[model samples]
Target: MATWAQFAAAEPELAVYGRELLREEQGYAFLATVSPGGAPRVHPVVPFVADGTLLVSIAVNSPKTRDLRAEPRYMLHATVGDNDTEFAVRGCAREIFDDTGTKWLRAHRELNVIDIPLETVLFALEIDRVDAAIWDDGPPHRQTWRAPNG
Candidate 1:
């Protein structure tokens, strides 16, 4: 898996477009996780990039949190606006247990006016793959990146 920085390094243009899409429209994204019964669960999430990592702060009691804890694999898709542009990332989440890391993420969240409660869990979404599609007049432009050995 690759950190956001690594993905950016590998595919600069796609990374920039993906970041723009992800941060657009209130920074909302759809996170897909696997339930304990092996069902797919999708939830809206506010995602941010901190310390070269894509992270999300989820309520500790949220069902998505439980799903993530039980199964780390996830697919996060940027919420499309009026356009046909699309961006998505597939990865595995790692829970943040270190106080310093969580504190840094919390501070960043606060700076962005993200209202994450204190009773929340932070997770790093390590990227295994990223895909993007941009449409204008003709055929849609598509791009994809995969982590080395991921």
Candidate 2:
């Protein structure tokens, strides 16, 4: 998998749209992680993409957090609304636990959520592939972006 900066550098325009889809207000997306038994477990999540990183903050004590720590491979899919625009990424996730991560988590007031019982932790998904299906007049336009081996 490649870093978000690497993917953005390779495909700026697509990255812009993809990032918006992931960060849009009330946006819907699904995060797929490997279960202990090697099965796929999908969960609804909110994605935040900024400063060349795509991250998702989940409950600190959640099973998903442990799942990602054990196995980083993941698939993230954006919900295609009535517009029929689709976005997805495949990558490996890594937890961000330093002060830098803490600051970011604090800056985003949305993550300061009170209803959640457990604290939240952020995980960055270094993107490997990006796919989009944008609606047009006729057939939907499709595009895929891949990072160059560096």
Candidate 3:
């Protein structure tokens, strides 16, 4: 298996953006998780940052949610700057659906108050490694991490 650091090293534009936006800011992340049958499911997730934890909500019936529930592995990607930079991470997913989970679920009333189950679990990945790959710039840049040292 490729180490998370090695994986990130292959893509630098992603690393640069991750280093920049991951600090006390709010942004969205795209999640990819494997289904029980080995197929991949991708979903756009609105994330919350608190104490360095990136929390994402998933409904029980959603494909991505089912994927994470069956397999606790995931990959996340985010980009900025007219697509000049890309940030990605690979790690394990954890579920949170208790008291605190309710608070997070209710944080956005406009979106979370829908008839869909509000008690959906929270899937969080602690960014095991980050990578960046820059295009349309001078030269491609890169960096790897054993864990998110940000």
Reference-based TM-score of each model: 0.93, 0.87, 0.68
Superposed Cα RMSD, model 2: 2.4
User: What is the Å distance of residue 104 in model 1 from its true position?
Assistant: 2.7
Instruction: Please state the error at residue 65 of candidate 2 in Å.
Output: 0.9
Residue 55, candidate 3: alpha-carbon lDDT: 67
Model 2: per-residue Cα lDDT at residue 93: 93
Model 2 TM-score on a 0 to 1 scale? 0.87
Error of 2 at 137 (Å): 2.5
lDDT of 1: 0.87
TM-score of model 3 relative to the true fold?
0.68
Predictions: Cα RMSD each: 1.4, 2.4, 6.3
lDDT of 2 at 119: 69
Candidate 2 lDDT over residue span 98-133, tens digit each: 887766666665553433332687899988788899
Q: Is candidate 1 or candidate 2 better by lDDT?
A: 1
Q: Compose the digit string of candidate 3's lDDT tens values, residues 59-104.
A: 7788887888789888877635344666677787788756765765
Ranking by lDDT: 1, 2, 3
Please say which candidate is ahead in TM-score: 1 or 3.
1
